[model samples]
Structures are given as structure tokens and as C-alpha cells.
Target: MPNTHRLSPVPSTLAVALALALISPLASADDASGTTPKDLDAVVVTASPLKGNTESVATPVDVLYGEDLDKAKAGTLGETVAKLPGVQTTYFGTGVGRPIIRGQEGPRVQVLSGGIGSMDASTVSADHAVSIEPFLADQIEVLKGPATLLFGSGAIGGAVNVVDGRLAESIPDQPLSGRAEVRGNTVNDERTGMFRLDGVNGNWVLHVDGLVRDTDDYDIPGVAILHDHEEGEEHEEAPQPNGTLPNSSVRTKAGAIGATYLGDRGYFGLAGSTYRSNYGIPAGAHVHGEEDHDHDHNGENDHEEHEEGPVRIDMVQNRLDLKAGVYNPASFLESINLRAAWNDYEHVELEGDEIGTRFTNEGYDARLEAVQKTWNGWRGAFGLQFGSTDFSAVGAEAFVPSTVTDTLGLFVLQQKDFGPWKLELGGRYDQVKLKPDDRASTDFSATNLSAAAIWRLSDGFDLRFGLDRSERAPTNEELFAGGTHVATQSIEIGDAALDTEKGVRAEIGAHWHTDRVDLKLAVYQTKFKDFIYLTDTGVEEEGYPVRLWTQDDATFTGAEAEAKIQLADTAAGAWDLRVYGDYVRAKLDGSGLRTVAFDVPHGDHTHGYEVDIAQGGYLPRIAPMRVGADLGWSLGGWRASLGAVRYSKQGDLAQNEEPSAGYTLVDAHVAYRWDRPASSWEVFLDGSNLTDEEARPHTSLLRDYAPLPGRGVAFGIRAYF
Candidate 1:
């Protein structure tokens, strides 16, 4: 029994009053000192094992910091970085989301913490949330294109690294330094607070950071259900509030502490962190019939009923990290860097206070690298990496079996400067083993090779090209799953005989930058010998549709472009215009292997259906084409921006999938800052969906039941001391 009461909308008068309060004139001073934006050639560490600037890297890289990061911050990593050139979110309600890069997601796109893998189970399913918090990050880096040579086969598509200064690499300039922020949003009465502090005493440095967040169910523009237009006798509609989605609330808290000792040559540090959260899963239950039904004279139920309820997840994680670096070391190595981390995570699914399922994961990752001095115009590093995880699920709704996975990899990278051109080459070898408690074990070996080049055509222009061959081993869920998944309303089946997935990718791009303009354009294509994907069988099991994990040949082609121009500059301020667009198309290569014909049960009745399993079709849940633009202005310590993004209709749908309509969203933000002798303070206001558009993200599996948030505003203040 769950609450079924309709929720009332937030009063318009309250929003107007808040807007007026935020717009009041306030005293502004000169721009903050030593806080200007970085140049285009900023150093990027994630692109290579060795340090390199953006201009020196052959692949495309996007970095967000300072005010830009604050403006893009959202509840999930996917939505926070969705505005980037070639990034999208697999939005599973407001509580869970993961980044989808270049139209590739799941195991293909790896998410990293600092320079190492996060070791979370977010990639295992759509409903699981990413474990990291964006509000505490100092900088986030997006490395586009293949990155398998450095991070292993999981990064065949790309990688996202969230850099938070938890483990101190260097001493702070001052003895004591810190920053704090507090914010609140009207969309769901959300409130968030965060703080970070660092202290230096003699040769020892210490760090501490923490954050807490809470929110109610978010608001929507219309009813939850997106009515189907088919001419039928009737379609049952659930009673929903006009402006709010049910069971969409969330609460989270996390903290970390670290200490480091600095010596003449290098530094060593250790850190420990803990994270806890409880969040409701929106529209996750599938009620085919009521708990009890009336019987007829023949001892059979005459009719069936449906019921809905609240579902939630309670999760916790504890992690420990160690880092060490030595400079000017003896022997063949000029420098050495070592990093290791261990994590213990667990989560339980609950249906109206009753436990439905529990998931647990314990893992550790370690990597060691040694950098060599320049030799014959070549400089690079060689490294060894090891990782292991034990994962298990119990209770009635466990869809995947318990398993242990282990991986070992060795890699080498080399770079040489040749006049106006730079060349880079890398290779890696990995061995992975998967062992299930109740099934046979499997092993896989993968070899990856990558080559890239950058040519400086002119003082303000450069050309880039890259090629890579990568392979990925199947995950445990794809090889041993055989159960009903209530979250997606489907009965899933896995094939243990599936083979490894191999892909070849080629890319070419150009970048131009100057004092007044910046532009980037890239085009890429990828072919897969064996690509693993989930397919619908056009049949029913129990009360749900049946889906199977399968493999086939596939291809993906896409392009992305972004440009910015200086509109005006005067004593008052500087104005700039920005435009960006991206598109990706995916298709299966071969024909069907067989045809499936069966009877699908609707309630208690059966209907016959047939589908060609061998017929080639488009991939499911692919993001549609998107185009957008923004205008920004900055004067002294004040800044303002406005932008709009339009998503095209998604008509190329897979078999048994529904199409999503296109919609546009508008947003705006304003901020003012004041600088003092020892600290700085800033206040800002951000508004989203200003037009109250009924926008639905095509990448979301629950788009028909959960639309995007309605019109709302957030105001906050930050302090640096």
C-alpha cells in the first residue's frame, strides 16, 4: 500500500517573489584576482599516461572548470555533462544517469575517478546511479574517442574522469585554505551543501571534504503517461498530479579525509571516504494483476486488477586510496608513480518497506607506472595494472548470478617530436577471468593497438588523425542471467556461448583557435566484428516480454562540431556567442538467423504474433540529432548567459520499440561576485525550462512515464577562504 494522493503545484506567486528578490541591485567590485579562466593549451593528464597539453594531444578533449562547471552542475553525471559537443545522458529518472559518449554506452564507456576506474556497478544496469558526486569536483575531463591503450578494453568508446583533490599531490600555498557552498532549488525543494578544507603544517598536509543533499519529487509539465494514439476500445490511465512525478525523491551524504607527507623528492598520501544514499525509483513497478482475485463457478479468476506502489533503494560505500610518487629515481626509471584503491559497496531494493533484493560488490584496483628520460627523441611510460571484484545478488528478484572477475594488463606508450608534427604509439595486452559460483568459468585475452598524429598546419590551426583496434570481453550479466527484471518489465535470458566483441575505429579532426574565435570539428566511423546487444523476442513469459542477449556485426558513423566567436568587447564587458551540434547513426549489418512466432498473453488472454529475428534493424535507445546555441556576457565581477537546445524527433526505432517526439528547452543564469583581501563571495541564480516545455529525452527508458522537470529556478552562494 503506497500513497496515491495527487500533489499540488508550487504557487506562482512564490516563484515571482523569489525572482524579484534575486534581481535586486547589489554592490559589485573589480574582478577576482588570480581567478581568470585558463587558456586553450591547459595541461591535460587523462589523455595520456605522461603529462601533455591540449594542443599536443591528437584526440579531442573537453575540460570544465570554475564558473563553467558551476553552471553545468546537475544531480547526475550524465545530465551535468550532457551539454558537451558529443555527450548525452541515459536519464533513468532524476536520481540515476550515466554518460553516453558518441552513441556508445554501458560497458563501452568507462567512468573514472582521478586517473583510475571507479569500480562501481553503474555500468551493470540502467537503474543504478553513479557513485561520484559532481558538486565536490575541482575539474571534469572528457576524453573523446578510443582510449583502450591506457585504460583497457572498457574504454573502447571513450572515458570521463572526475578529478577531486582528495589525495594531496602537493602542499597548499598557504597554511590554511578552504571553500564552501550552499544552494537550494525550487524544482523539487532540493537543498545541497558542500565544504572542502586543506591545511599545511611543516612537511605534513591534511585534507577534508563533505557534502549532503536532499530533494522531494520533481515537478513535470503534464501527466505522467504519454497516451498512445492507436484507435483501440480503451486504454487505462493512472491518476497523476498535474505538475509532479511520484516516487522521485532522493537523499545523499558523503565525507572524505586524507593526509600526506612531503619529502625532498616526492610525496605520499592516503585517504578514506564513505558515501550513503536512499532514493526512490520512479515508475519501476509492473503490476499485472492484484494480490487477490474473485473466483468463478469453475474455480478460475473471472477478471484481473492492477496496483502501483513506491519502490526505493538504500545504498552505502566505503573506500580507501593510496598514492605515492618518487622523482629522480635511480636505475632505468627517471620517475615512479603508484596508485591503489579498495572499495566495499552494497545496496538493497525495497518495495513498501519489504526487501525485494540486495546487491554487494567488493573490489580493488592498482596501477604502477615508471617514466623514462628522453631516448632517441622518444619519451613515454610503461605500466602494469591489476583489478579484481566479487559481486553477488540475493533475494527473489536477483537477475544476475554471483561471480568473481579478475583482470591483469600491461601497456607501453611512446611519443616523439618531429619538427612541426608529433606522433604517438601505444599498445596493451590484457587477461580477464570470470568465475560464477554456480556455473562454469570463462577466460578471455585481448590485445589493443593505437596510433595518432598531430600536425601544426599554421600558428592558429592544427590537424589530427587517430586509429585504434580494441576488444571487449562479455560481462557476467550478459553470460549467465536468467530471471525477471522488474525495473524494465522484462524476462531476460543470456547466452554463455557468446564470443568477444572487437571494434576498429578511425577519426579525423581539425581545431582552430585565436584571440577572437575557437572552433573544432571531427568525423568518425567504427565497425564491429561482433557487437553484443539486447534484442526483443516478440514473445511473453509469465506476465512480461522476453529479451535475449545476442551478438552481430554492426557499424556506427557520426560527426560533431562546435564554434565560438567574440561578439563585442568594451570597457564595460565582453560578449561571446557559441554554437554546437552532434549526430550519430547506428545499424546492424547482417540479416536474421531465424523467425520467432508465439502467443503473447495479455492479462489472461493470448494473442498471436510473429517477427523475423534475422532481419537487420536500428539499435535501440539511440540519441537523436541535437543542435544548440548560447550567448554570454561578462563585466567586472558580473556574468550572465542564455541558451536554447533543440532535439530532433527520433523516428528510426528498433522492433517492438516506440518513437519519441522532439522538443526544445531554454535556460538562463546570472551571477555577481565580491572579492576581499583574504576571501571571495559569489551569489548566482539559474533557471531551466523557462518556457515550461514538455520535453522528453529519447535516451531514457521511462520517457513515456517520466517527462523532464518543469520550469524551476535555483539560487545559491559560494565562499572561498
Candidate 2:
């Protein structure tokens, strides 16, 4: 590992490390074996049809399972993995958070459930929450770069695949096995409970799982809204909510049931699941005037008897899925896998006790994959995927018009090995069509090609390289939106003449491992011909600023590194140290025509009138540089770890973006386990924000109003049989 020590007056890597360590406790220790939880690198990368582990695949991947997964689990999927290198999460109060990969978010990053789309409206807006529950996942895989060749063109940023194992592929070894857990948190008076049961009956396998989580408004180190420190300017006194964030509570319930038929040559399975949540939007984050409350009631137009109050979203989703596989059905074929899912989702925003707006969606996704037998040292897979969605909104906040979208895709993957080296190549094509209400129907086509190579330098080291050319078609909201959105308090305008985004990326990685040490590093760069983004126009309509969806040439460059060393082993036990750091630089390219420039924000102002210029410009909400380290020790049934990370102050501002301050977070945890012949029990204590620092994420749209939870501790117990 490189040295990061520095003086107090200087900006140093250690500063970054210290800040990261302070944010939250990462999941890295394991009790399964004497070895650390880093062993997940050897697990299969299910997102890929190649069925290769992270160490064998050319693509950069991260996997967390077993004991590591138990410790990392959080209320939202994004929060569960925010500590990973090169990954961050977007926060919108206590309930909403979506994963951001290399500064790419929204539709650019895909969230998948068992190799398929999560089939939710999360990508439609920042205020929406992801439907997939992290507490139920069996394993979570993160593809850290362009995954267009394996997933879809929209995955130019990357993909997060949660493998819940709802539909089993094989029978269990024991007659019955399962796990249960219950936990409580101090910051929010949280109570959460979850359980899973898997059983075998003759030639059939059964599975059932469920979870419930509830929390009150959480505590904060200071006032909920920090106007004084904003832009580093002093502000006059104003009424501000203190200590606890108002209207920031959350409640959720989710469950699933599945069964599989075991056969000699093939297997088939089905699953059904439901997710429901009611969460509040922070006080200052959402503001609607009395005029906006008049709704269509009892065949009347704009009823006006409603009273003003806080805003909350009630969401629910019902889904069904099918999976089937055939092994050696053909003489020259290896296997065939088929999967499909259908979802019905709806959400309503409430004003006081009255309904203000409602959104609904119906969607289905299906895929068929076939693996071919190896011929002359070459092997590959072919796949066909199709999906459709009908989405609509009603009432005051219906900014985007209702629309129907359909997609069809075809892809192929091939690879061959020669001695100590492996070469892989892939290609994909997709066709997308959109039909908007009272608008012309539009169609788009996208193609992607990729190549990768892995060379085993020695028994303990490996090097890999990858290159790809990808394209992404615009979504309906990006092409036709034309009204105000209450959640974001912005007037959005879309462009119908927008073109497909094209990008070329190159990445290189290296890994070295030994019994007592492991180290990995990767560097990547991508150039986009037409990068689409929402820019503040500096124009206002009824107190809300107008944001336009536009595109321009852009560039993204980043690097990530992680290391682990077994520092010592004595009569007391073994001690280990882990450290990681990452950063990404995103900016509009100077090669393109000059883009708009604004006078920019100061003291709560968004921007001034827009202007034009020809120069480099920073992208907004990109996570600042981070570096962190953790030390762990174990003796008998007791295990413990403590760590902190430093997040640098993000001064790279978009024309209208706000500047965020720097801060560090500290966290620690301790767990004890006891084993029996047929059962095991474990109890843990998790602590976060030990310093109670006032920190706001740069990636949050409500950073000026909502802060992270204050210092708190959580206690939990788990049982497995």
C-alpha cells in the first residue's frame, strides 16, 4: 500500500481515508472460515452467462455474501454497498437511495434482480425508492464499469445484481434449513425482523421469506437544514427544524414465496413477491402551494377545501417470476436457461390527509439463454431478451406524460483460453419503441461491442484489460417532459430531437494475492459522443427553476484501489488491516461546441441567467475522493472491527450546482457466535457516526436540508439451522 501520511495544514490521502472511515462501518470480516470475508472474489459472477468467478472474469466485479452480507445489510440496497470502492448512493430522505456508479446514475445505471431488471419506477426520479430489498438477498454482485455487452445499452455506467435465490435450481442437502434475525436501532427507534425457510420434500424444493422494518424520524447532530455553512457563507437567523428531521420516518414490509420441481434432466420453478412502503419527504425538500392542493373530487374540477400539511409517499408492488433450465437436452448443447417476470407497481403522494398525485406502472421482462458446447477450445452463449412497460401519472405532479415502452434485444458471448491467458468478446443489439399519449410514436436502435483479455502473470498475480463501444436510447421522460415536478421543485423540459448516446471506454486492472496479503487496482476512462444531462436553465416559472434535458460530449476518468494485510497473529488471536480508496473525474469535453454557463449559485441561490462558453465544465453531484482503513481482531467466538474514512470537500461545481463541505465518519462493530450440531446463534452490536459529525452527501438533492443520522448504536441477534 502507498503511504498517505501528511501534515494538518495540507491536503493528504490520509485525510480522505479518515473521512471514509467515519461515514459508516463497511462489511469485510467473515466467520465462516479463519480467512477474511474477502474470499467472495472466488464466487461466481451470476450477472454474466459465462459463469466465471471475479478472479477468472475479465470484467471488474465485487461480491459480498455469507458473513460479510449479514453485516453489510441496510434498509436500502444502495446504503448496503455505499462503502465499496468506486460506488456511491443518492439520498432522498430516509427511504430513497439509488446506487451511483462512477458518477453515473438514474437511467444510466441498471438495478437488477437475479440477472433481470428490478421492474420498478426507481430510475424515473430521484425521490423514488428501489423495490428490491437488501435484507433478503443471498448474494449481491456489482459490475463496476460498462456492462452493455452482458446486460443492456442502458448499463453503460454499470449494474448492481441482487441474487435472492427465490427460484431454486437444485434441491437442498438437508430436509430443512433456514435463518431468522431481529434488530433495533437507536438513531431512529428502529425495529426490524426477518425470517427465511427452505425445505425439501421428495423431488420438490420449497422456499419462503419475509421482512418488516419501521423507523421514526431520526436524530441529527445539528439542525436539519444547515443554511449557515452553505457555500461557506454566513446567513441571518431563520426558523429551522433542530435535532430531528421532520417528516422523515419510514415503514416497509416485503415477502416472497417460491417452489421448484426437481427432475432428472431439467428443473422448473415459480415465485411470487410483494413490497409495500410508506415514507415521508423531508420538510424543506417538498413545498406545494395551496393552489396546488385543489384536486378532482366527485366529478368536480379543482376542489378547494383541503388543508396544508406534510407530504408522504405510499408505494406497493406485486410481482411474479418463472425460471426453468434444461441440462444436456441436446447432444451438442451444454444447457438452456429461461427466466421471466411481471410486475404491478403504484405509488401515491399525500397532502395532509388528501391524495395529491398517484403514479402507476405495469411491466414484464423475459430472457432465454443457450450455452454451446466447447469446440476447439472455444465456448460461448446466445441470448434473447424482451420487455415492455406501461406507465402513467395523475394529478398535480404529473410532469411527464403517460407512455408505453417496448424493447427487444439479442446478444452473444464467446471466449477461449490459451495456457495462462483468456480472451473474451461479445456483441449486442437492441430496438426500443415509445408511444406517448397525444404524441408521435418514436423508435430507436442501439448496438454495443466489447473485448476483454486476462493474463495470469504468475501464481499470485493477474492482469486484465477491457474495451467497449456502447450506445443508449433516450427514455420517454427525456424526450417529452414539460411541467413542474413537486418532489424536486423544478420545471422540467425535454427535447424531442435528442439523439442516442454513444460511448467508448477502456479499463485495465491488476490483482495480487497471498495467504496473508491481497491487493487490487483498476483504472478506467470513457468518452461519450453525446452525453445527456438535465441542466438548470436559470429561468423560473411560478417560483420553480426550469431544467432542460440536453446532451454534449463528455469524459469520465477514474481509479480504485484496495489492500488487505494480516498484520499479526499471537496467543491473543489474529489481527488484519484493510484499506481502500477511489475517485472519478467527470466533465464536459472542450472538443464539443461550447455549452451553456450560468452565473451560478451563492447563499441558497441556484443560478443566474444562462450564458454560453467554450471550455471544460464539471459534472454535478459526483462523489468526492475517498480513502478509508479498518482494523479487525478475532479470538475464539468473538470478533470486532473499527474504521474511518475521509471525504474531500467537493469544489468541482456544475454551472448551477451547490458546493459541499468535507467531513469524516467513524464506526465500529463487535459480534459473538456460538455453534451447535444443528443450529447456530450470533449477537452483534453496530455503532455508526461515533463522532456525531454534521455530514451531508454531495450526491443528495436535499443536502441543504437533510443530513445523515446522528451517532447511534444497533443491537441484533441471528439464528441459523
Name the regions of candidate 2 deviating beyond 4 angstroms. Answer: 1-41, 228-238, 289-307, 591-615
lDDT of 1 by residue, 220-296 (tens): 99877674223563535446556898888999998899898888898798999888888887763333312221221
Provide the lowest-lDDT 10-residue window in model 2. Answer: 1-10
Taking every candidate in turn, the Cα RMSD to the unseen true structure, in Å, is 9.0, 6.6
TM-score for candidate 1: 0.90
Cα error, residue 99 of model 1, in Å, equals: 0.3
What overall lDDT, based on C-alpha atoms, would model 2 receive against the true structure? 0.83
lDDT of each: 0.80, 0.83
